[model samples]
Target: MTFPIRTPDDLHIEKRDLKFGRDDAPPRWWHSNDPGRTAFFNALSSTFPVGEKFFMTAVRHYRDGTAEPLRSQIDDFLYQESMHSREHVVFNRQAQDAGFDIASAEDRARRTIAWAKRRSPIQQLAGTCALEHFTATLAHDALANPEHLGGASNEARRMWQWHAIEEIEHKAVAFDTYLHATRTMTPFRRWLKRSVVMILTSLRFHYVIFRNTADLLRQDGRNDWATWKGLLAWLYGRKGLMRAMGLSIFTYIKPGFHPWEIDDRSLLKDALRLLEAGKPKEMAA
Candidate 1:
């Protein structure tokens, strides 16, 4: 459930055409009816639409010279990321209706991505590789542990489920692109660069996600000690998300690490089921 270490030479990358029906907005604490958990997911969504563009840019930088199947996969990756960004924009607007600071969150996300673009191309790809892992780990967990989305509104849950599925589908593209683009660097140097960036990326994400979560929760009047205590428990308690995600993050340090090495593609069954359930009748095959 934790590690996502698997790849196939003939991996089929398909864009899922699914729609979440949101005729009416859900409560502000849409996640399981808990402000803290809701804040966590909202904070993540706030960043996803804007931040994923940087991911596409990093992959595109090195994808031009890739061989046949990977070239096609990279194209699919670009398309999926564009779709993901757009979907999250819709999701964020819903959060805005709930009084969350969408403008401030967008500002922070853009500033973060802008800073990342200023780094060397290799570094930018390294950061993207790291982020892909972060998201893929989360996606794997959501599929493996249904409780993660237990309290979510149907529409919101469907969007995240769909997003998670696509994240897992193309989990290795950025890393593969990184290797293709960094032929000039020695293996050891490349490892060092990626390892260092993953560490920093982890820290920066932790800080920003929670900072945004706290801010959003405050706006929702979830400022009590009981709320913070319950939220912290949900994050760090046994089988909490951060704990589940840690192994995947640390695995990047292993020699000859490939994302597919920790294969959890079996989890895709659940994701596929969700996709099937969410497809518009017109788009249903």
Candidate 2:
């Protein structure tokens, strides 16, 4: 059954929880005290530049009228992504305050965004939908793993956990929007396009992670052997990061595949609590 697309009300950025970045507020994942885990998280943090660019590109695509239902999704997507960017910026600064060279890290992030922008719009959007699927799976795994983020401080873990929950929440919106917008494409062709995009984007993400990790290792005075080991461990751990990502990508080919279809609804209760606690005025349908 086709879900009726609804146009959400205009977003009020003013109503968002801006208190997230204040000085007295707790540090997010990027600034946690555990040196070993913090290094890992800082490396992971490098991925957000690409994430933000993807969402911004989606916002632009929807605003241009290429996707009908996505037009409404764009507002919430943009708002949430803007908040993500802001939080990460603050987190990056906190990392710098703790002695890392954030300026260099940010420079790399800017270069990556430029690369994403140079790709064709359709390619960019498809890559984003694939990444969204990857994140949806990662979010689920993260919520499941008892020690997934064991060393993080309470505030840091809370922030990342909150972000993960929301990522799962809207995971399918982009893919569904893309499907609706490109009505002429055959289902088989769409799946093929999605698979190709997923492979290419994963390679790009891996390249970024490799480069960023090398940079971090250089700054931290770590030997190449140790750094490489850490990278390998992250990918090959029991959770099988890349394998899970591939499985998530494959799920797109299944009939009725959607973010909510695989979701653990209990996690969503937390999101609902946050929404009600903030109580931002809801727009009339």
Candidate 3:
């Protein structure tokens, strides 16, 4: 099936400034009342503040060199990412309030991002591109499959829904920026670098997420086999989020991969309508 090719011209950044977890914290098991599932999302949220900063910096470094449309898209991407970071910071605080040591997880993410920053600019951009694709794939599933995040508290669910919507909207910005950054490099060399970096990034990203989830689970005295089993099942089982996105993830390393080639914007529109309905009139305007 041929998918319509989406470009930066189609990108629009919405500033929500939405807040959550301030008045009442979601229950410890916010997602489906499943401690394992809850910790998995909390672990992922804990990384966003620091990780998003890394992504913005990496993409912004190449903005001056990019031409029209893409240059403007990079600006939108940075702003949207900053908003994601802001909201996730609030969400992570709720995780901490729920008795999980989200600070430690954030610290680890900070250190990881710091290490990535020490690399060459292009390598950092390559890593950002890889990570962006990962989030975009996850975002696709989060919207397409209700069961993925079903049973979460309203605030938490909307928070993720908003985040997922924006993720899909600007999914291609970092990748296009990376391509522009490496415009002078040989195609083979560019592919090899992004491919290698993506492999490395994927390994470390999952390790950190799983490790953080385990740590959070331990805080709940859930170090038992069942907890671990459920967590694994949620991630890699037949209906696993990760398993479902395996093909989408692998497409990143294809010779001429571009995020919009997947054509999941129909999902984005439905998600946006849902999120917009919840927004205050002023903000929605």
Candidate 4:
């Protein structure tokens, strides 16, 4: 299928108005207004800086003529990801203001960037594709598990939900670009490398979570039991986050799977219509 990449005409990235503890936003079940939530936010905050670097990397790759079709999407992708990183950074600041130490989280993120830089360009591209797939699965899970996320304030939920929808919307762009750039790679090798990257990256991410959670718990005078229980509960929740991730990964095995193919375009159309409608300011907000 020919993927005609189109950039949205009206993409804005204003700084969001979000307060940390004073906001009406309730924490996620895993966070439960606990110290763990702070840790989670801190970890998430680290993504923005990494995202900026990734954006530059995409631009560099695009300029080098690696993937012509995706060249059209590069500017849009950069805009979207830049905004995502900014909002997440704001969210992280809120968590820090609410008592989460974010220094270590930043350090971990820097280390991740350093590691990525060490890889060859093709390896880095493959890694990017794998990470994109991982994020797509996460976006789906976030939207599906409203119960877990429902406690967040209306505005916060809307922000996250919008982000999730867009993540799904652009899911295949990077993968398709990678395929086009690296056509010589055998399918078996591509799948194998993707699987390996997923396993390794997941482990690294979980390790950061574990460390951050432990730090938060210790600071709050909570024992290991509380931290372990929260983590376990999140993993074993009814929505089965891990299971969804595994299932989503299998989409790579399908020969012609693309994000646009799986996405509910009608929902996107409806959202666009709503966005275009002249609703009351508060109601839309």
Model 4 lDDT tens row, 218-244? 666764786667755665566755556
- Candidate 1 worst ten-residue window by lDDT: 1-10
TM-score of each: 0.92, 0.77, 0.92, 0.76
Choose the strongest candidate by lDDT.
3
Candidate 2, RMSD to the unseen true structure:
5.9
Comparing candidate 3 with candidate 4, which one achieves the higher lDDT?
3
- Native-referenced Cα lDDT, model 2: 0.61
In model 2, residue pairs whose N, Cα or C atoms come closer than 3 Å (at least 3 residues apart or on different chains), thus clashing, are none
Which of candidates 2 and 4 is the stronger one according to TM-score? 2
Whole-model lDDT for model 4 versus the true structure? 0.58
Superposed Cα deviation of residue 204, candidate 3 (Å): 0.5
On lDDT, who's better, 2 or 4?
Answer: 2
Task: For model 4, name the residue pairs that clash.
Answer: none
Predicted candidate 3 versus true structure: per-residue lDDT over 1-285, tens digit per residue = 122225645556555566765666898899999999899999999899999999999998888877777777888888889989998988987887777887678878888898899999999999998888888888888888878877888779889998988888888888878877777788899899999999999888988887888888889999789888878887887767777556555788899888888777678788888776766565569
Question: After superposing candidate 1, which stretches have Cα over 4 Å from the reference?
Answer: 1-6, 278-285
User: Which residue segments of model 2 deviate by more than 4 Å?
Assistant: 1-18, 24-36, 63-70, 227-231, 240-243, 253-257, 270-285
lDDT of 1 by residue, 1-285 (tens): 112223685457778655554576878889888889999898898999878988988889877778766677899999999989888888888888887886776778888898998999889999999999999988888877888887898778878888888888899888877777776778899889889999999988888888788788888788678888998888777867876677777788787899888666677776787757766565576
Candidate 3 vs candidate 4: which has greater TM-score? 3
